[model samples]
Target chain A: MANTTESNLPGDDVLEEPVPAMQQLLDNPFLLLFIGIAVPTVLYTIWGVMEIVNLPIAK
Target chain B: MAVNRNFRTCPTTGLVFHEPAEKLMRWNAVVAVVALLVGGVLAIGVLLTRWQAVHLLQADLFYQFLTAHGLNMLVFWIIFFEMAILYFASSTLLRCRLATPALAWAGFWLMVVGALLNNYAVLRGDSSVMFTSYAPMGAHPTFYAGLILFAVGALIACFVFFGTLVVAKAERTYHGSVPLVTFGAITAAIIAVFTIATGAIILIPTLLWSLGLIEHIDSLMYRTIWWGFGHSSQQINVAAHVSVWYAGAAVVFGAKPMSEKVSRTAFLLYIFFLQLASAHHLLADPGLTSNWKIFNTSYAMYLAVLASMVHGLTVPGSIEVAQRLKGYNNGLFEWLRRAPWGNAPFVAVFISIVGFGFLGGISGVMMGTEQLNLIIHNTLYVPGHFHATVVIGTTLAFMGLTYFLIPVLFRRKVAFGNMATWQAYIFGISMSGFSVFMMGAGTLGAPRRHWDISFAGNPFGYEFPATAWLMIALMGIFGVGALVGGAMYLAITVYSVFLGEKIQTPDFATVSAKRGMAPAPQPVAVGATGHGAGVGAWGMVAPGTFVLALVFLTSFVLYYFVNWKYLSTVWPLK
Candidate 1:
């Protein structure tokens, strides 16, 4: 998909040149994926453990 | 090889807008600036008191400061800004003149007078009962008087909006649909009616209490009703924030959501379901029954959360579509590449959304939960979460919008363009850093209002969390960022008004163009254009979004209906 505007990219009409660093990061979606899942998992896991600790054992 | 010009730009202004509508928007920005300054001062004072580790005044005075700060910043500043922005966006997009300019000015004065009286009461030591004026914490007679006056002023503003709607309707300017931004605002205004009404309900009695006519008001009752006002007022903020996002995306980058209809529906959901969402605030507070809390806080919040989730997905979904269309298609990275990252409004909106979604959403959900809220309720975490979302998210977007809005509104040359970019970065980074630190301190169990952490007789002689202190001190750096950024913005605005280059703007172009006429474009973007493009697109679904806003509306209605069917015989309301 192209930008809705008819005007060309001003001055520098550089098309589809991949920036190395961004490309590298994009290649590994797992990094963001890991952080996303790991973070909430840790937090919620802590919450679950706390709940378990606070639970009363039936006699 | 070439596309038929889907959009046109005027050679004179280098953009598109109607003249009168632009003028009205400019006036709105001017008033907003005044409101922001007043609110900012109160906020700065509060922040200083928190940061300096010294009580500037006694506890009572401090309470007054806190009260004044909340009223000034939260109610006066944000609402006034929203009103101005809302009017500009709605009227411009609809292509109509303000139904009554006199009514708008009247609304502005009413709010100004109300704010002035409220502040004056606080200064006089007449009404420092804090913003909520929770019954027995009774304010001075003057304080209640000011509140009533302010509420009245806001009501008048609402009426002025109706006037705009009437004008738009009668003139056939809107072409059978309200713009998305205006539609969201209508919902916001609808919620505001509830918010202000609840505010009036609480303030009138509190005012009576201050007058000595009423012996005493119950704190519990006052708080319950007060939250009705307090909670919903924030919904107005939430709606405004969403509206700003839409506007900012469109203006800054020429981005439009894939489906205006879906986005508009999300906003309407807020109107129907926002009042019930307030229960989340009281989840941890005592006095409310567990059952009441569950229904109002937990169950009620489910719909609100769903609403947020829908938006959480949909807004970005729209952006993703926009980016895709822009030909960023290097897979996922292609979208990122194609986004208008260079635009200040674009960057600010993105950063705010990301930060609010993560930090604000995290703490908000945790605090609203029945079980998790117990640990962090009333802690510094509460403030941290709110500031992250409301301040960084909403306030930053407003600032970003203003960059374009001020130039167009006032028809003045922006004093320092490059400096504005740096200012945005500094402001965004610092606020985010500060919020994270504050939230961390909260988790460590640091109390919010203790001037010092010193402990005289505790069994554990350690005064407070050392890490908390360090984090808070670190937050001062961000405070500097906020101050400097604010100063830069102020300087540009002032310079533009007095000394910047002047340009000839067309007469009545804003309203006339909105009415779909081939009108002369003015120097700057009007309310519903440029920074508010997404909002304009969203306007098409104004009437319907309220009916089907998915964010909180669905869960809210479902919760209400379900509970009504099952427990109506036993519940308190019945």
Candidate 2:
């Protein structure tokens, strides 16, 4: 049943082709998730300090 | 042929994850968590400062943090996450590639850069006008620019979602009707498009005015049109989160709506009527006529509330029917009692339904009343009411969905198992208390957005009875607990995604992939004439949920009348 469904997919021939191992690693869900989380955390921490310096006294 | 190559089948769930779409979802979800972290830290500062005794930050810094907190949590965190959900529903559920993966990446980066720019403007200390940013009290031009970029990005994302739906239909991804979850996502995307358009219409001019391109922006015009963006943005959250509720029920319990036609009609009702609730904000303004306010707040808005009530009943009713079929059929709540309490997703859904209906729903109707609006217009009660809706209702449901995504999408075992189990309860209960205490203090005449509730050193100071101070203190304590809970969620998710044990399949002890993203199973026919199953009948299937609904209605009625009675005392008959 699963194989039949796969064969019936709209572009089965293109989907079945294998990809380079490096692209596969770069596309790993965990790796992407990590970059997503880490970049913001680090940037925001620096931004927080920048905010404090820019606005030393509130109007 | 290209379509087949770009998508991979999840072995456990059998859902197709298009490579580019999957990457986009991961990035959006990650950015959302980071936004939540920034907002959470600021939340603790604001909460402490509001508690008269602690009064943590100075007046200027308090307002700055308050402005940052509102935008980051309400706009940045939720919209980014909803964008991720949009991609998941369209591409993954329909088993098709995203319509424009490159455009989707552009949207993501625009939103990130825009959010950071907005934060930078607020942090500079000049834009302490709070989230409303009403006219004549102008901020730097960059604030408006950041918001415009964010709105445009969100608008593009919504179009991408709509395009994906078209692709699904063109390719015949499903046989007949799209799944209920996908339909719900469509409702969210439609509302988001309207919301972003309104935002752009008002904000673009506001940006020009700030840069001295225009003179004399009217405060009333700004308030009236801005709510069309501000409050309606929340309506988008309501649609998206309630969809999450239905999706969570389907995923966790294998549940289907008790009446699919009724549920779909309710979502349609949302499209027409939900935005009208924005009038509640303008009710107190002298510029709007009483007749217009009355029509908007009462007739049109009640229909929107009715849609919510319909959802409130059917979501749980569906869960009850599913449990009954599984033979948890002892009494009024055995089905509920025997539910998967240990599971984070189910816990979030159940708590969200209860909190949104009881706290958010009731208070909303009360505040929307013309006379009642005067009582709590800019009081702490307003924020209290929305915390119930946005935080408990939408944010918690999103958090629950994250637990499922961690293992399924990221392919890692959940870290800090005990903390993950307690995260929802700690956050939900403390937030529930926070809402109650904030409202209580507002009832005692505490002003919202005042740096010092005590009004220290003022020539004309009015003391708000000692109890208001106590309630504010309690709000601070509960807020701290909620912050801890939010931190736990962030910690657990971050550690798990980065460092936890890797898994090849979705069927780990922490995450179940039994049904996955497949369409919900059809409910069993209960009263078939040929079989002995006819003995049980339709009435027996969801009795527990019916009883719960009755209890909810009774509480709502009592609360409504109590507010009226309180109003009568405030202005006795002449």
Candidate 3:
């Protein structure tokens, strides 16, 4: 994995640079997008499965 | 000198191709095309016979042609092309020599021989059981043996692909991560390994049963495990073709994924959740528990659907962003309208994206739903759904890629260029119609795999509505249109590869470029600083695609509700 650690070059005054929250989200939009799509889909699917489970099978 | 001896740089794409691996890839692709031709011919017969007006073949011949068509198209043609793709993704894309070239050749021949043997069995009138050779309806032993050999060969090719990846890593051929397209191929190859192994476990026993070494294979068990092989094979195509879609974006527009990490995660979701879709096949089987069916079809399956949705959004999203960066940011659809529409690869991939999503993706989810499956299970709708996916989605993508390969790999100018440009639209639109009409007929309860949908001469003859006949006739007409498009493709590719004028240098982009269109977009250096540096980084450049995604979601929701409504009508509550 590529990581962004503080460099020891000429401008080594800062210890660690914090990545902005918005930039972090921007960098990984698919993650948020996937979660958003997946959560509702998972919930709906679970509801569907429960409905099937609760149904009466013909004798 | 070292590089020139073993590798040649494609002047067009600037990708290095290891010499021996190039030969293997070419051979596999050529044979895949041959298989497609055979399958395409058989498709006409089957379609004509099913049309009712033509009623082209006798019952036995219909079954035979159907069996050959299904196996040749679904198995031999697609897998052979994918073997070539695996080699290209690993050895070519990674700039490494293919590991064990001799073993790769052996694997290729094994696949060829197995394909021939299976074809011979079908042609001999002994194995007309169709692609899913369910037990108790025994095919000749050679049929099972041929399939086994083919599976083993494919397994070897998968290993060779993995080995090439290892070599690439060891040789430091590529820096940073492997390309996203290569990553997607790896996902497909992994799923293929599992699919082939399950295929072997089931098929070897079936072969023995055919040879009288074993007695009484369980019918339910056969159906149970066979789908692990059957449906999972299509899963392999899904992963591979999605990889092609990404590759096409990169090749044509030099587009990068919105987020490589996110895209890769979606692929991982495929590996985990996609195979469970095999359960949808057995949903109506009495022996299986509803819990098993419901869990696999609903819960786990939706994760797989989500993965596809992620891809569906990002692929076009990447293209939209790339186009916006190139000053096509006028309106919501300016980026889209300004796209190189006449470009074969662009048209093919774009059509594949839309058709797969609307026809294949939506119908698939609807059919996989338990109650909805009750409505369309074992009907022609099943084939309708897959035709959209496997044919429109995968085959069309492969066809698009072949245009690029002709000059870069085969070193010949694409012949009949105008035909190639129009071929994607003709084939795509016709197949889209075929799927829609077939599904419509299936909804009216058209029996799949029957010699006659009319139920002619049965002891208990039943009449279908007039609309069912109309839909089926339209399906047949559209099928012929698709066949014409297919023929044009074959003629263009065959002439280009074998007989067209040789070129010292070919401009790859010109194969798809139209006169008076804007010049081909310069390849952009992705992942550079400031590429995604601003407030607009949240895919604001791809607002068109974002709206398209919303439309897709709306379509999915409405379709889901409508299916449930249809299901409610099927079995009314007291």
lDDT of each: 0.62, 0.79, 0.82
Which segments of model 1 are wrong by more than 4 Å?
A: A1-59, B1-24, B52-61, B453-462, B504-574
Q: How would you encode candidate 3's per-residue C-alpha lDDT over B333-411 as one tens digit per residue?
A: 8878999998999899999999999999999999888878999998889889999999999999999999989988898
Pick by lDDT: which candidate is best? 3
* Alpha-carbon shift of residue B477 in model 3 (angstroms): 0.9
In angstroms and one decimal each, the interface RMSD of every candidate reads: 15.5, 14.9, 15.4
| lDDT (Cα) of model 3 | 0.82
lDDT of 1 by residue, B33-101 (tens): 776676666656666666645425555666667787777767777887777766765565654455555
TM-score of each: 0.76, 0.87, 0.87
For candidate 3, what is the TM-score? 0.87
Against the hidden true structure, what lDDT does model 1 obtain? 0.62
- Give residue B270's lDDT in candidate 3 (0 to 100): 82
Tell me how each candidate scores on DockQ against the true complex. Answer: 0.02, 0.02, 0.05
Question: In candidate 2 chain B, what residue range of length 10 has the lowest lDDT sum?
Answer: B527-536
Tens-place lDDT per residue, model 2, B387-492, is: 9999999999999999888877887888887677699899989899999899888877899978998888999999889988888889988888889889989999
Would you list the rank order by lDDT, best first? 3, 2, 1
